[model samples]
Target: MEPVVQFDHVTKNYGSQVAVDDLNLSIEAGKFVTLLGPSGCGKSTSLRMLGGFEMPTSGRILLSGKDVTRVPPNKRNVNIVFQDYALFPHMNVAKNIAFGLELKGLDNKSIHRRVSELLELVQLQDYANRLPNELSGGQRQRVALMRALAPDPDVLLLDEPLSALDAKLRQQMQIELKAIQEKTGKTFMFVTHDQEEALTMSDTIVVMNNGRIEQMGDPSTLYGRPGSVFVANFIGETNLLRSTVLGAEGNLTALDWNGITIKADQGGLSPKAGEHLYVVLRPESIHCSATEPTSGNRIKGKIRQRVFKGNHTSLAVEVGDGAVLNTLVHPGDVAQLAGDDIWVGWKPETATVIPDRHAHR
Candidate 1:
C-alpha cells in the first residue's frame, strides 16, 4: 500500500542545532502511527513538518505520494489537535466542531449534520450546546478532536493531546481516541513521550532519539524484541546487565555477567569472543521462587524491597556488585517471599543480547 505520509531524508535545523536529523519514515493509510521519544527527541518536530507548520531544512515530504514539501498548512489536507486543545473560548462545542466545515464554505445544513455526527462519534451529543469552559478537561479535548475531524482530513495529527489532563483522564482519553481513530478509519500521526500511551494506541511505533529514528515496529515487536539498547531501556523497564561474549556455538551465544555465565539467543547478530554486550531481561520474564528450580537461567539474590501492585508484586533483588535485578511475581505467591534470599530464573530465549555502544562508559 502507498503511504499516506512520507518523510524522505528530512532534516530540520535551527542554525547549528538540529531538531530533526535525516528522518525517513512512512505512515500507512488508516494506521495509528505514533512518534515516541523523550523531550527534544524530534518527534513533535516531525509531526510539525508533516502538518506543514514547519518545513524541513533539506529533503522532501510526500502526502499520499504527492510532493508536499513546500505546501502551506492551510493548503494541506490535514488537521491537528494541539496539546492545549486550542479551543476558541467564545465558541460552544457545536460551533467549535463546525469551525473547520464553515471555513471550507460548507452549507449550514451540512455543517450541522457533520457536527452532530462528530458529537455522537465522541459520545458527546448532549454536550454540543455547552461552551468550551463549561465542559470538563476530557470533554474539551473531545471537542478539540471533533473540530479536527469535522473537516474529514485524510490524516489527523495529534500533539500530546492528552498531556494536560490528569492521569486517570489521560488513560480514559487514550481508549476513546483509539476508538475514534478506528471508527473514522483516518490515518493518525500521534506524537507523545509517553511510552504506555504509544504502546496502547499505536499500530506502529516510531521510537526516536537524538533527532533520528531509532526503531519503528508494532508494539509487540518493539517491546519484545528491541533492536538496540536504547530502545530496550526506553520502551519499558528492563534489567540491563553488562556482559562480555564468552563464546558462540550454533544459535546460542554465551555471555559472562560478572562471574555468572548465561546463554542467550544471538538474535542473528554475531559477536566475537570478549566483545562487550548487554543482556536485556524484562522484569516479568524473570520468575522469583523460594526454592531453586532446575531451570534455564538462575541467579541467587537477596530481596531488598517488595512492592505490592495489586495484580503483581515487584521485587528488587540485589545480586551483588551493586547490581539489582527487578522481578515481577504474582501477588498471591509473594506473601511469604519478602526480604528473603530468592532465586530468580528466566528462559534463555527471553533474554536478548545487543552490543552496547557506550560499554566503556
Candidate 2:
C-alpha cells in the first residue's frame, strides 16, 4: 500500500543547530504511528513539518502522495490537536466540534449530523450543550479530538494531547484514545516522551534520538530485540552486561563476561570473535534461586540488596567485578535464602546481544 505520509530526507535547522537531521520515514494508511523520544530529539519538529507548521531546510514531505512540504498550516489537509485543547471558552461542545465543518461551507443539517456522530463516538452526546470549562479534563480532550476530526483530514496530529490529565486519567485515556483511533480507522501520528503511551497505542513505534531514526518497528520487536544500546535502554530498564563474543553455537552465541562463559541469543546478528558486545538481560528474565539449577545458564552471585515492590521484589545481584545486575523474583521465594548468597541465572534464549555503541551524547 502507498504511504499516507512520507518524509523524504527531510532536514530542519534552527540557526546552526540541527533539530531534525535528514529524517526519512513513511506512515502507512490507517495505521497509528508514534514518534517517540526524549526532549530536543526532534520528534515534535518532524510532526510540525508534516503538519505544515514548519518547513524543512531540505527535501520534501508528501501527504497522500501529494507534495505538501511548502504548504501553509491552514492550507494543508491535516488537523492538529495541541496539548492545551484550545477550545473557545464561550463555545459549547457542539459548537466547538462544528466550527471546522461550518468553515468548510457545510449546511446546518450536515454539521449537526456530523457533530452528533462524533459526540456519540466519544460517548459525550449528553454533554454537547456544556461549555468547555464546565466539562472535566477528559471531556475537554474528547471535544478537542472530535473538533479535529470534524474536518475529516487525511491524518490527525496529536501533540501530547493527554499530558494535562492526572496519572490514572492519562492511562485510562490512552486505552480510550487507541479504541477511538481503531474505531475511526484514521491515520494518527502522535508525539510523546512516554514510552508506555507509545507502546500502548502505536501500531508501529519510531524511536528517534539525536534528530534521527534509531529504530522503527512494532512494540514487541522494539522492546524484545532492540537494535542499539540507546534503544535497549530507552524503551525500558535492562541489564547490559559487557562481554566478548566467543563463537556461534547453532542459534546462540557464546559470550565471555568477565571470566564467566555464558550463552545468549544471537538475534540474527553475526558477532565476530573477540568483539565487545553487551547482553540485554531483562530484570524478569533473570531467575534467582537459593540452590544451583541443574538446567540452563546457571551462575553464582550474592544478593546485595532487596527492594519490595508490592507484588514482587527486586534483587540486586553482584555477579562479577562489582557489576550489579537487577532481577525480579517472587517476594516469598526469598523469605530466608541463607543471607545474600544465591544463584541468578536465565535461559540462553531469554537474553540477546547488541553491539556496544559507546554511550549517547
Candidate 3:
C-alpha cells in the first residue's frame, strides 16, 4: 500500500544550524504514527513541515503521492491540534466546532449535523452551549480535537495534545484519542517527547535524534529489540553494560562484562574479538534471589538501595566496576532479599548486543 504522507530526502535548516537533516520517512494511511524524541531532536520541526507550518530547505514532501512541499497550511487537506488547545474563548463548544465547517462554506443544515455528530463522537453533546472556560482541561482538549475534525481532514496532526493534562487525565485522553482515531480511520501523525505515550498510542514510532532518524518500528520491536544504545536507554529502563567482546560464534557472542564472561545474542550485530560492545539487559529480565540459580548467567551483587513501587520493588545492585544494575523484584519476594548480598541471573538470549557508541572514540 502507498503511504498517505511521505518525507523524501527532507532537510530543514535555520540559518547555519540544521533542524532536520535528510529525513526520509513514510506514513501509511489509517495508521497512528508518532514522531518521538527529546527536545531539539527535531520531532516537532518535522511535524510542522508536514503540516505546511514550516517549509523544507531541500526536499519534497508528498501527501497521498501528490507533491505538497510548497502548499500552504490552509490549502493542504490536514488539520492540527496544537499543544495548547487553541480554541476561541468567546465561542461556545458548538460554535468552536462549527468554525471550520462554516469556513468551508458548508450549508447550515450540514454544519449542524456534522457539529452534532462530532460533539457526540467526543462525548460532549451536552457541552455544546458551554464556553471553553466552563469545561475542564480534558474537555477543552476534546473540543479542540472536535474543531480540527470538523472539516474531516485526511490527516490529523497532534502536537503533544495530552501534555497539558494531569497524569490521570492524560492517560484517559490517550485511550480516548486512540479510540477516536480508530473510529474515524484518519491518518494521525502525532509528535511527543513522552516515550510512554508513543509506546501506548502509536502504530509506528519514529525515534529521532540530532535531526536524524535513529529508528522506526512497532512499539514492541523498538522496545524489545532496540537498534542502538540511545534507543534502548530512551524507550525504557535497561542496564547498559560496557563489555569487551571475548569471542563470536554463530548467533551467540561471548563478552567479558566486568570480569564475568556472559553470552549475548548478536541479533545480527557483527562484533570482532577484543572489540568493545554495549550490552543491553532490561531490569525486568533480571531475576534476583537470595540463593544462586543453578543455571544460566549468574552474577553476585550487593543491593545498595531498595525502592517499593506499589506493584514491584526496584533494587539497585552494585555488581562490580562501579556499575549499578537495576532489578525489579516482585512484592512477594522482596522480603527475602533485603540484605545486601544477592544473586542476579538472566538467560543468554535475554541480553542483546548493541553497538558501542564510544568504541569509535
Off by over 4 Å in 1: 359-361
Candidate order (lDDT):
3, 2, 1
lDDT, candidate 3, 245-327, per-residue tens: 99986788999988989999896888899999888999999999899998878999999888889999898999876779998
> Could you give candidate 1's per-residue lDDT for residues 294-333 as a string of tens digits?
9788888898888888899888998867689988889677
- Most lDDT-accurate candidate: 3
**Candidate 2 structure quality by residue, lDDT tens digits, 1-361:** 9999999999999999999999999999999999999989999999989888898999999999999998998888899888899998999999999999998899999999999999999999999999999999999999999999999999999998989999999999999999989999999999999898999999999999989999999999998999988889999879988899999999999999988999999988998899888999999898888889877788899989988899998889998778788988786776866579898889999999998877322
lDDT by candidate, in order shown:
0.91, 0.92, 0.93
Residue 180, candidate 2: Cα error in Å is 0.7
lDDT of 2 at 228: 89
Candidates, ranked, TM-score: 3, 1, 2
- Output the number of the TM-score-best candidate: 3
Candidate 1 colliding pairs:
none
Question: What is the total number of backbone clashes in candidate 2?
Answer: 0
Worst 10 residues of 2 by lDDT: 352-361
Clash counts per candidate, in order, are 0, 0, 0
